[model samples]
Target: MTTYTLNQENLNAISERVSTPKYNRTQLTTGIVHIGIGGFHRAHEAFYTDQLLHDTSITNWAICGVALLPHDTKIYQTLKAQDGLYTLMVKEFDGSLSKRVIGAITELLFAPEDPSKVIEKIASPEVKIVTLTITEGGYNYNEATGAFDDKNPSILYDIAHPTQPKTVFGYLTQALKLRQQKGLKGITIQSCDNIQGNGDMTKQMLLSYVKLADPALIPWIEQRVAFPNSMVDRITPATTAADIEQLKTEEGIVDAWPVVCEPFKQWVIEDQFSNGRPLWEVVGAQFVKDVEPYEKMKLSLLNAGHSVLGILGALVGYTTIDEAVNDKNIHAFLEHYLKQEVVPTLSDLENVDLEAYIASLLQRFGNVSIKDQIDRICSESSAKFPIFILPTVKANLKLSRQTELAAFVVAAWAIYSLGTNEKDEHLNIKDALKDTLHKQAELASQNHPEYFLEIESVFGNLKTSKPFVDAYVKAYKTITKEGVIIAVQNINLSQINSI
Candidate 1:
């Protein structure tokens, strides 16, 4: 039982074990510098770029993956050891698996180890596209104010020490300053996170950061950088010990850091690059003039839909997303929310079969192999709701459409923030506003929905809306009284009766 390590030497040996990359690795040159290298980036962006490198003409579009955290040192070491090659297993809806060796990342850099090297790479004229997946909170944005929070301690630290910065905005500002000083061309900054208008938001945050840190570089940055909005989708779960062992036992390959995801992957990008970009369109990426509709559709429908499943699933003692979606009531609740509440917020798009999209999401959510956890989806609820759920709530309110389901989703979050499930199991609360949320949750436990809703940072003035208040109060009382499962079943019954 010989175990083959995932590296260039073992590529040929493990041909039967996994899908080894066919392109020549040695000839690949770094054209893109990707920040916040994580499981999603490896599965989505790097996966697409890896496919593009198959064409000999596009050999220069290889990625130099950089992890900016001290916690990323292990991943940085693992990726470096394997020459930036790792396994990507795509779990299909039919329980089928497609395993491939992603070789798009030719270099790996740990910013904590060598900040100068990382800055130099991003500042290089050869690197035309700088991408990020630094999560929602990483932007240092105050969602309530719709602006970058300059007072954030991290931003403050980065502002004070520009050269040795900690956050992504600081690095970008410093890198752009270097480019300006060197008379180098500007580069595109693409954000592949789940945030809405990711590119526009990044641009706003970066410009604001520059203005506060170094005002002189603001105009240069304004002229040079292009933050194109994008919608990236894939259900890549956190790699576990079981996944690692399964790869070795089943595939006979030992990968230190492998990304596991669903078979479906999509990247809808606005075709606006400052200097130049990889021919991503050649690899199934949609390059369009406007990414707003697509972004809204995905965020409001898929992302917000996940939160609904997560909070509800967590409450009913469901562990995985598959387990949650498999429940008839939870599944119906998701579909109802999507069709009744979420879809009406957007106008029709060209060639976009949203029905098909919802069906695909249903299948994706029910894929047992991926085992997407409710806790994982529920992790960033505080930051996520403002981006994903609140928009639809706002839209539906203006249209005067039924907001019962939307209000339920937010109420489900309020209930979940109590940090315990129906079984009295201790739940993990991962949010920037954890203290405030807990305080509000304690107050809300006494049947005061206003305690949670009045967190103007998240709900805004929506707390004052009588319709939303009525719906949220009813849902909150129902769940607390009848239990999570019964409340879901009751909602479905009511919907059926109304029809």
Candidate 2:
């Protein structure tokens, strides 16, 4: 087997080994500065940008990927070493693999290594778009107040040291300030995260941050910057050592940080930009006036469906998402939840077949090649629940619909957070709210399931709703008493009596 490194020079040698960029890599310039350039970005946005780059005319739309956190140092070094080249392998449902070297990222920057450089690059007139995939928790949003978390330590630090900032909001604000001072045009701050009204939320958080840190810039930002709502979907799992070795053995290419995901991909963006934007629509990216319906549909069905399987799968000792989805009981539960409790909450979406979408999601989840970890799906669930599942659950409650399965999803999470499964095995809790959730879960274990719902931010007013509370408690008790497998097999919509 011939060994090769993934880089510009090695492209010719590795053409058959993997899909290399066809165009002149040197001609590509940074027009987009994407923050939080993780697996999903590489798999989705970068993937789309790579396709668009096939057009000889689309030279300036290349990405200068930015990694802000200290933890992202590995990826920064990996991408930097590889000359911004990395392999992306899409695993199809039939077990075939499609491999390509993503070259949309022309450069990589580690903000922690050089904050000033990041701020300067973001302020560059060449960069028309600033994108983020900083995850739901990274926004520092206080859902209760519907504002950016001013009390957060990082936000507070950024507030005090206005110019020498640390957080994402700080970096963005500082850059915008420089751009304004230079009399340069404003840029679009696009969020590709899996949140409802992601663009609106990005605007809200940025504006709030600017208002608190530097009120003078608020007007300029409000007038100039555009935050386009977008709905991005893909199932890129965390990279593992096995994945690394597999790529080397299969493709004969060494990539320090490669991305693997299912073949399915979707991006629906609101066509609002401060400056000229990429012709991404030519490459399968949908630009629309409203992304809210699409957003709701994806969040409610696909995302919430993942959560249900994630929590329940972990409880039932299923490690990967596919394993859980392949299980007859788990698959049935997901199908039922999507068709019964989830779909009713979503209003009509144009050109969308909701039933077919749900069917596809189940099929996607069952794709064995992807190997998306159930633990990964359940990770940051504290942030996930309010954004993904809670909205649909709330909508169902408002409609006087039975949310037994939805409520069960919540109970599954609560039980899973107890730090043990039905078999008394240790369970990993990966949430910012872990300690608090564990304490609440401990109380719920003592036959006080309502205690879990008392976390007002997560459960909201649903904690006080008698019917929801009752359904959740009953579900919690059934899982606790009969074991997860028994509870799962016993789940039936017909058995759920209305409160």
Candidate 3:
């Protein structure tokens, strides 16, 4: 029988580390307000915060987690059930593991439950840095224009009644307004999303929304807020019952909420904070003058490679990336795609060896125990494509010749939009452009094969380039006639070299 409920003993047993030696929980205060409290935050930022708490200098940096959607309430309930204590398991491919109980989060607030409470927390003077892990779609930017969509009801509502309807931007604007009113020191806004120039992106969206709402707050935000771009990497799969049972049996403790992540972790920050930040460099974070090259390397190589594997894995009926990577054709496809197409386009990667990086990525994808799902990776492709594939495509296209391997990725994305697996089973696609894609696919099936390219938001700028258009059309034709596996097999280094 289980011997513990919401007691500190149970928490200590589950974490495998005693809290008394690490953190003075009573002394902790809400200094950092995390906007999107998802699984990634629980595993990554919160994990770092937990480590920083041990130093006592930053015990006050305890996280105040906020959830914007209804679905997140469940996470809130689970965390609250465990007295804000949960286990984070880092599993390696070789079976070595580490587990820790994270207690960095001091409180959880659901926007829907109490919007005022959320705004009040963000407006508080104690909150120093506001971090976000809201997935690509959460930003509410229009893919076509690369700008904020004022037409979005959420944005419109937030703008119409700033204090009444709270969004990440709304909360930020209100908090800044409060800071302005009180003449308090400004805070840094750190974006932990995978988007390139994430800090700039967040600043743009916030300012755009603010300009529409109140023009007066613009200069105030300009002088006070500092948006720092960052590159964050961690492979954390969705938790399952099997994971729960394994932990229960292995550790003799049951945690309603536990985070499982791959052994690999990275956090690269731009080192531009307004009100100061923790000495996270001591805890393995890289603080650099320029994160652009690193950001490009990570987004283009690691993220783009992940997307390629994910789409192909789903189409081939493979559940996890490990299974997909094990297939000879898939493995060869990735190797060729990265080496012949993706690698050649990236310039000035510091001391990074592209070959070694690709090998490491392959190893991570082949970790069968991690079980990173293709569908999970495939979600929010619209937001991911611009960062992951577009730059490579543009770079390859600018060369004297066009690269078919890069074109194949675009073609594969079009094929993926058809919404069926290799077995012809319907696939559940999650994207901001889902409705438009369905209609576009229907039109293509009827007679307008070129309609897919007409998605100006996605392919609009590329459509003007004849070489890219020709490559895309040719690859799309091949995919339609021969299927993905054969198409991928036929692609070679010579084809990319020709471009």
Every model: Cα RMSD to truth: 1.2, 1.6, 2.2
Q: lDDT of each prediction vs. the true structure?
A: 0.88, 0.89, 0.79
lDDT of 2: 0.89
Q: 32 in model 2: Cα distance from truth in Å?
A: 0.3
The TM-score of candidate 3 is 0.94
CA deviation > 4 Å runs, candidate 3: 1-9, 13-21, 55-57, 446-448, 493-499
Is candidate 1 or 3 superior in TM-score? 1
* lDDT (tens digit, per residue) of candidate 3 on 32-102: 99988777988888888888787557766888888877778888888777767777878888877667678
Error of 3 at 258 (Å): 1.2
What value does the lDDT take at residue 354 in candidate 3? 85
For lDDT, the strongest prediction is: 2
- lDDT-wise, the better of 1 and 2 is 2
Q: How displaced is residue 200 in candidate 2, in Å?
A: 0.6
Please write out the lDDT profile of model 1 over residues 260-347, one tens digit for every residue: 9998888999999998888888889999999999989999988987888889999989988989999998999899889888888877
Query: TM-score for all predictions?
Result: 0.98, 0.98, 0.94
Error of 2 at 92 (Å): 0.9
Error of 1 at 213 (Å): 0.9
